[model samples]
Target: MRITAAVLEQIDTQTVPHRITLEQIELDDPRDDEVLVRVISCGVCGTDRGCLHGVEPYPTPGVLGHEAAGVVEAVGRNVTRVHNGDRVMIGFPFCGRCYRCLRGEQRYCEKNRDLTFSGYRLDGSGGMRRRNGEELAGRFFQQSSWATHTVALEQQLARVPDSIELEMAGPYGCSISTGAGTVLNELRPEPGTSLAVFGAGNVGLAAVMAARLTSVEHIIVIDKVPERLALARELGATHTFHASSDTVEEIKELTRHRLDYAIEATNGANLVADAVAALGMRGTCAVVGGSSPSAKVTLKHADLLGHGKRLIGVMGGGGQTPAFLESLMALQGQGRFPLEKLVRFYDFADVNRAIDDSDAGITIKPILRMPA
Candidate 1:
């Protein structure tokens, strides 16, 4: 089938910077274990920016959207999870046979890297190509959803209820789910505990909202943006802070040096140190930010061992999909999660503009609506 897609032609350089253009391309039919979807909407995430800026390397002429919601157009003979006309969101790509997956931890699938960033399917053949016979990297996260249509593995599909709006369901696949899952699944902070979340972007804000649902007493949100801090307060943060040299001190003082948990959610701003510095003894910090593949963090041995402070990395929310996505939708429907406050819609053609706004921190979550 012929489809329209945003193709990243080149990385941002001194001369030609951030060049992405819409073009007509050819998409292959779904494989035996895949399903074809007509994307209704997709979210622009930090990972997309990382790829565009060369922080992450994806092949040129590739589609780069992983957080997507759509209606199933067709299903291959072997697909049984979704069918025609069913509304669904694409989740992380995982090899079902991996040890972690067998243990119900699909988020840590062994082939996650290849399935997500390798551009080609595991068999080294992808479903995207140019009309002229050139191959395009279109299997990003198994659903390269930047296009009008995409082929996704049957296992990655999450059906959305009729009560949930399709536009509001896309981000649950990644950013939103990552933040919420870090709290609900990973941290699981106890009652009367305190949690400070650094960087009030979609992920941090989602952490704030999820914290409110818990019995955790103090939900402190930190960010450089005043509007984001204020919005975090409205989304159930008990306190908000503007990032500064004294931000750690403030968080320490607020919790009387007994901060129970902290989360780092910046887009490679390196706030992990600040999050750790504010923690009390035996406190745990969850880092969920997107960074360059080569980026690394340094931690002081004494600070960690002496205080028993633990730092952990979370990927795609540290839980199974579809079920977790469904739970988030239910919470959102109940007026609890309230993720809609952070969402701003854009036309698919204005994807670059949306990316620009996200980079500028003008939009917390940008959902691009595809043409019918």
Candidate 2:
């Protein structure tokens, strides 16, 4: 089958428009622990932008996308949890043998990282390729969801309720998961805690909303974007600080000189310092953004010496797969959380345009709709 796709040919390069031609490709029956999906909507995540624009490193001419949701077209023989026609979200498939997978942290899957980051198969075979039958270096972060149809490992697929709109369910793959999981799984803010989120983008706003759901009394959102700040307030932020303003002072004034936990979702290293300074004793600051290869952040040893403040780096929000996503959907269903306002839809061919909108802060989350 030939499909329209956006292919990143190299680092610091743009995704070239190409028809991904496949030979010997099969929608073959799922293996004992695999599933096939017809992807309907895939969100354009920051990582997807990075890969297309070359911030993080992945193989060239690769299909790089992670946030995806679709309907199941087939199920493996051993699969019983879900059947054909189920709605699902997919990520990279991880081998369950490693210590990370055993600990329920499948994001750090040992085998798939090489397969995922390298844009090749576990056996080093390229999944997407050129019309000449030469490999195009694909399999990014596992599902390579920038396509209309996808084959997902059962381990990485989440069965979402059919009542949910396909577009609304796509972002749970990365943006929403990163924010919600950072609070619920990593930081796990306690009742009456004070929380601050830097850079009120999709991830940061999600964190702010999650903080409101918790007993966290003070939710401070920091961002240079006025519209985003307004949206944050609408989503339950107790206070919003304009980054152009004296944000640190504003947070201090709102917090009575202390912050319990802070999540960093920006590229500015100084924002990290501000988050650290705003914390009280025994505070936790979770850094969830991916910086450039040369990007660095500094901390005062004295802050940790006696204050017992901890700064933690979280990858994929340190969450357990499927469970975190399911929990969020359930909350949304109960009307306790509404994440639909964050997304904007676009045609699949507008991949570059969507990235530009996300970069310009014109759109919070962009979902590219494939032709049905």
Candidate 3:
């Protein structure tokens, strides 16, 4: 079927910067294990910006969007989890045959790198083609959804309840889930525990909100933006600190020298060190932010071994998506997790503007409404 999509002709250069043009394109029919979704909305996440700024790799003349929610317009044979006309959110892609996937840790699938960033099927075939007969990299995250229609693996679809708005559910696939999952699934801070979140962007704020639902007594948020800090406090943070040299000191004072959990959800490597520094004895720090693949962090050996502190990495919330995403949706329905507060909507035509606003920190979570 012919569809409208935003295609990046090439990577961003110093002079010829990244650009996406709206064009009519052809999308192949769904394979036996795939579904065709009529994308209603999609969210622009930091990872998307990372690709746009050349910090990440994505083959160009391709569509880019993983956080998408839409109706199932068509389903290939052998698909049973969802049927046509069902509302669903597109989650991260994973090769089900991987050991990690078999163990229910889909996020850590061994082939995740190629499955997500290869811009084509694992078999080296792309689902989209330009009108001029050129193949377009369309399987980004197994659902290059920054277009009117997309083909996705059946396993990647998470059915959203009718009560939840599909427009607001896309981010749950990545950014929101990454932060909330890091707290709920990985950290699992006990009641009355003290927790500090390092960063106040969407993921950080989502962590703050998830932390509020926990027994964590003291929820402290640290960030450079005063406004984000203020918003964090509103969301559930008991204390907010300006990101500075005194951040660790202030958190120490608040936790009385016994911070139980710390989460690093920022792109900056320095904050990872800070989060590690703020942990109490045996405290664990969860890193769930997007950084360059080549980026490295140096930690003090004594701070880790001597104190029994753990520095762990979490990807896509570190668990299976069905239960986790459903739990979040249920929480949102009960008004316990008000993730909707962070969203701002833009017309699909304003895709670039939405990216610009997100880059400028003018928007927390930008959801682009695809033309209906």
Candidate 4:
């Protein structure tokens, strides 16, 4: 079956529309441990924006999206985790046998960077591109979900509850997971802890929502956008500060001159300095934003030494866990997380526009739905 998809023929190039209908590219029917998914909903994430503008998988004519959710159309012989027809949200494929994966942190899988970005299949033949041999890189993050159908390792895809709408839950694959995992897995803030999160975009908001579930009493969010600041307050931030306003002093006053942990969601280098300065003793600041390669961030050494501040860089919210995803789904169901509200729907045809809107900060989360 041939399908239409958003194709980027070159890095740093605009998404090009394909008029020549291309048929589906098949894998050798999965590798005994693989499952095939008919992707119904895929989110245009920040990573896709970065990649589209030339970051990971530098070469172009690429299939960019990684946050995909769909039904399991088929599976290989050794695929015990899921059978055909099961709905799933694909995660980053982890080796499962690596030290990091053994520790239940698949996002940090020893080979995660290369595995997700290499633009080649483990065996070398990509399952994308035109049947005529144009060669589009598939299996990006092990699932080039920008297309209608995607092949995934059974290990990376998570089966979701039938009660939840798969389309609305797509952001959980990356954006939500990154935010929730940082607080739930890394910070684990105790009651009365003061935490400051810089940047109130999708990832920052996810952290805000997840932070509300924790005992952390004061959640302060900072962003340049006034609308995002207001949204953060609605999402669960105890205090909100506009980056355009008096930031550092306001944060100091909000924390009464001390802080517990600072989650840096902005790529700005100076905000890192501010987060470190706002911390009390034994503080941790986790950097979770996706910035361009040219972006450089610098922090002071004194801030680290004087207060025992720890800076940790996180990936995929410390790797998606069933428990975390389930909890996020449950929260969304309860109307607590309200992730759906963050999304603006776009027809599959406007994927390029949606990406543009996302970069322009016009849409919180742009979900591209296949034509009905």
Best by lDDT: 1
- Which tens-of-lDDT digit does each residue in 322-352 have in candidate 3? 6688789889988999998899999999999
| Backbone Cα, N, C clashes tallied per candidate | 0, 3, 0, 1
What lDDT, from 0 to 1, does candidate 1 have?
Answer: 0.91
Determine which window of 10 residues in candidate 3 has minimal summed lDDT.
265-274
Name every residue pair that clashes in candidate 2.
8-61, 9-61, 129-136
- Write the residue-wise lDDT of candidate 1 on 8-104 in tens digits: 8887877778788898999999988999999999999888888888888788878899999999999999998788999999999888998999999
Write the residue-wise lDDT of candidate 2 on 38-127 in tens digits. Answer: 878899888777665566677665677788888998777887777788888875467778988898887676675584677765767555
Sort by lDDT, best first: what order?
1, 3, 4, 2
Among all windows of 10 consecutive residues in model 1, the one with the lowest summed lDDT is 290-299
| TM-score of decoy 1 | 0.98
Candidate with better lDDT, 2 vs 4: 4
Tens-place lDDT per residue, model 4, 308-365, is: 7888888878845555776788778877778876889887777878877988899988
- Give the winner by lDDT: 1 or 2: 1
Question: lDDT of all the models against the reference?
Answer: 0.91, 0.75, 0.90, 0.78
Shift in Å, residue 90, candidate 1: 0.6
RMSD of 3: 1.0
